[model samples]
Target: MKAPRVAVIGGGLGGLSAAALLARGGCAVTLFERSKHLGGRGQTSDVEGFRFNLGAHALYQGGAGMRVLGELGVKPAGGMPGAGSYLLSGGRLHTMPRGLVSLLTTDALGLPGKLELAKLLAGLGRVDLAPLANITTRDWVEQHLSNADARAFILALVRVMTYCADVDAMSAQSAVAQLQAKPAVLYVDGGWSTLVSELETRARDAGTRLELSARVSAVLLADTGARVRGVRLADGTEHAADAVVVAGGPGDIAALLPADALLAHDAARAVPVMAATLELGLSRLPRPDALFALGTDGPWYASVHSAVAKLAPEGGAMVHVMQYLGGRGPEASEARLEEVMDALQPGWRTSVVARRYRPSLLVSHWLPTAETGGLRGRPSVEVPHVPGLYRVGDWVGPEGLLAEASFASAESVARALVPGQQVASRRAVGR
Candidate 1:
């Protein structure tokens, strides 16, 4: 008996993970990617001697992505910066409040503001975030703490964690859940593209055929719309498969299917957030004391990748400054990010060896919220309306952000494909 043939669309982490797992489980897998390279937005570009990623990517310790990597025996070599992160306020950089002592000692807030913040942090564990789902982060902050200082600090934290501002648009429940989860942050040693390469290798070693620059134009569905036969390529060629998994962005994937196709409605409704990233490769390091920093008053974040990862040439430094913007054009966002980077690393302009600016990158497919409404926003992996078809992506039904969410969807679909063999457990990886 021949093994079941599976077709995976998109070469991003979710698709790669599913392909690797299915292949490992004795399935004949073929993964199709439209781009010349794999990894989607998680890719790293080489300009001159500098290694710069599409954006700042930090794997949450013990999150779903790490678990998948662990299963493949791919250990990402690098740890968090020892000094952690700082917050910019009042024209000064202050130690971010990590604990009661830091909260009390930090000059970022006044005595009254500190007490209010402490109370809020203490009560965070007790709050039923589900109820706060409909509430915005701004609304939640206003209700909990009236002090402007406290509000600015908390809002900045939310932006840093979620990479989405407009607290009025952010789900309070989602914000609280993220804060409560508190996953460990880690920078991969050789950049995320290296991780993508490793995953590709694992899939190939397991006998999964990866086809790049193969644009899938459509998913072939049976007349009853109850089953997927395979996919049609842009070149008008059809490849048959027993099962099909789509890992593209929700909108892009939905466009491949007919209006009546399963999960199409949900996919169309997904709200994606845009990320603006400014990557600067310096001839020398700056702010070597800490690994991360956030602008409390401004919508910006900066991290020194070289301090934690081998993403730059020897003696050179790689820094990523990001701003999650709403409605702002890429050019405008880039200009704002440049200013933020300049502030974080004074005289960095003179030290610049190479630089790249990404005005717009879809960071999240479905905006996560604390409310029940946001829960059903993401479509599940299994397509009940269409058998032999599944979806896996950051926007798919999973309770995590970015890589974690992508892995969660991939793991769910893989487990469903091969339940008895015991695929990688969905455990968070941490130091």
Candidate 2:
């Protein structure tokens, strides 16, 4: 039997995962990446003995990403951040309430607010979130809680979890599902590049050809424009393939298939989630106790990731301060994030070993909104009217969020391409 040749675009997590899985499933796979480096947003940089991810990043313990990595036999080493965190409200930092003792002792919320919050938290697991897909987080909060402080606190938590500051536009169902997915997250050592390296190695070992710096100009289709024939590179080189998977943002996909109405429509509906971040490698943290803080009155987050992950040298600290942007100008957003740094680490400027400020960073390609039916509303893996053409990315799948969504979409594409073959059994047969 002739093996089906598959071409994967964008060498990020999703592309790499799909390439490896499909190759293992008796398909000839070739992955093309525009950049010299892989990982896309997952790439990490090192400066002055400190490793910095593009922004604050964590892996949900039981999410689709972890499951996919496990299936690929890749184990990432990291540590979970401690529960000791603070809430910034009214220009004051208060110990975040975690358990029963802290809930009673914390001054962040009043007695009534605390009781209401506790009750809400207790019942989060049992709540049927499927019906809440069309409800916004703001509406959900307003309808469920009367205490102002509790309402604000819950909104802040949702922002931190989903990294989307537009609570009025975000879907409550997606927010609640993310919150209920076990709050434990791992901060990877050596940053997310660890996962990238592992996936790349596996892809290569599985006989999948990876072409770096290969910019795909267009996804070539047959004369009828109904099926994928191959991909054309920027250099005018064309590679023939039986299938092509586009693993990138909506803009990338739309640009490739400019005449496709479905791609155009999906691109118009995509809402980007952006953030301003200031990452620093400090000589030492001035206020070590203020390791993690979330703003209750604003969209701000500060975390010392090096405390849990080995991202810095001995005694050095790596801090990431971010402000989830909600239609705010980049200049103002950057200033607000700097203010958060000032509050969390007083006199931090003096101890700065290295620093990078990104005014506008794309946190996610699409913000799961109420109008779109939350996560389930995203586009499917197969491209409509274009057989053998698929899409995989953070914004394409119905399951998971962020990197998890990327992995989930990639897994779906792999399963669709080769239905009955398992990764282990197929690999044993050898490419």
Candidate 3:
């Protein structure tokens, strides 16, 4: 049988993973990336001997990202953030109540609040999430926890876990699942670009032809408009393919399709999760003890990522401060993130060797809303009414969140394209 020719649009993790898997499954794969570089948001920048990811990037140990990377023979190495995290409330830092000891001793919450939070944490994993799929996180928190401090603390933690501030719109089931998953995460050494490099090497080794700087202008369809013929480049060049996988955000995919397509209409309605971030590379830390902090009074987070990853020089530091944007403007959000940095790392301005302030960053393509029924409500990999056309991205999957969802969606599309191929079993990849 002649091998099917597959053309992949976008060169992010999802696109690279799909291309590699398809090639390994006996398909001839060609991957197109619009930018001169691959890795989309996964790309990292190195300045003054400090490597910085686009924002704070972490791989959840229990999520699909690790599992898929393991199957792909890619092992990401980094250190886990220690348990000594702080909670900022009333302009003071308190030990974050994570385990039993902290729960009992931390002054972040009162005795009643601590006990209530402890009970909720203990029962979180065992809770029946199906019934809560349609419930918003705000509604769930309001109905379940009576202690104000406990309620505020859990909401803050949810923001850290989900990178979302819209609790009133976020699905409770999705938030709970994130909390229940293994709490450990890895800040990849050298930045997230390491993972991108690994995936790129694997894709090329598996016989995928990567075409960087190649822009896909549109998804070409047959005369009946029922099947994907291939893709047309921005320069008027066209390549034939048996299948095409668009691995990008909703808007990117929507722009390539006809305005009348249902997928395009749905994409227009999808809401993005956004954030404001400040990344700094410092010559030295002003307050080394203040390594991590999350705000209970607002949607803010600060972490010394270099402490857990090899992103800085021997004695230097790399800190990331972020504000999960709800309805705040870019200027306001950036100011809040700066305030968070000042509160967490005093005198950080003097030690900074490099600094970057991103007023707005698209953290995720879609916010899993209660109205949409959470993760299960996301679009399927297969494009309805269009055979041989597929979509893969963080917003087009039913499992995991963030990069995990991207990997999961890619695997799903690859399996659908090559039905007989078996994905490699997950291996024990070194951290």
Best-to-worst order by TM-score is 3, 2, 1
Winner on TM-score (1 vs 3): 3
Candidate with the larger lDDT of 1 and 3: 3
Candidate 2 regions exceeding 4 Å error are 327-331, 423-431
Q: Write model 1 residue lDDT over 188-211, tens digit each, in one string.
A: 887888889989999999999999
Per-candidate Cα lDDT values, in order, are 0.79, 0.87, 0.87
Give the least accurate 10-residue stretch of model 3, judged by summed lDDT: 422-431
Across residues 1-431, which tens digit of lDDT does each residue of candidate 2 receive?
99999999999989999998898888999999999999999999889999999999998887778878888889999999875489987667898887889988999999999999998888888877778788998899888899999998898888888888888888888889877765678999989999999999999999999999999999999987589999999999999999999999998999998988889989999999988888999999898888888999888899999899999999999999988887332333667777787878888889999999988899999898999988778888898789989999989867877888899888888899999856322110001
Model 2: lDDT equals 0.87
C-alpha TM-scores of all predictions: 0.93, 0.95, 0.96
Task: For candidate 3, list the clashing residue pairs, or say none.
Answer: none
Give the Å error, residue 183, model 1. 1.7
Give residue 354's error in model 2 in angstroms. 0.5
- How many backbone collisions does model 2 have? 0
In model 1, the runs with Cα more than 4 Å from the true position are: 82-84, 261-264, 327-331, 369-372, 424-431
**RMSD in angstroms between candidate 1 and the native structure over all alpha carbons:** 3.0
Q: What digit string (tens of lDDT, one per residue) describes model 3 on residues 40-102?
A: 999999999999899899888867788778878999999999755899877678898768997
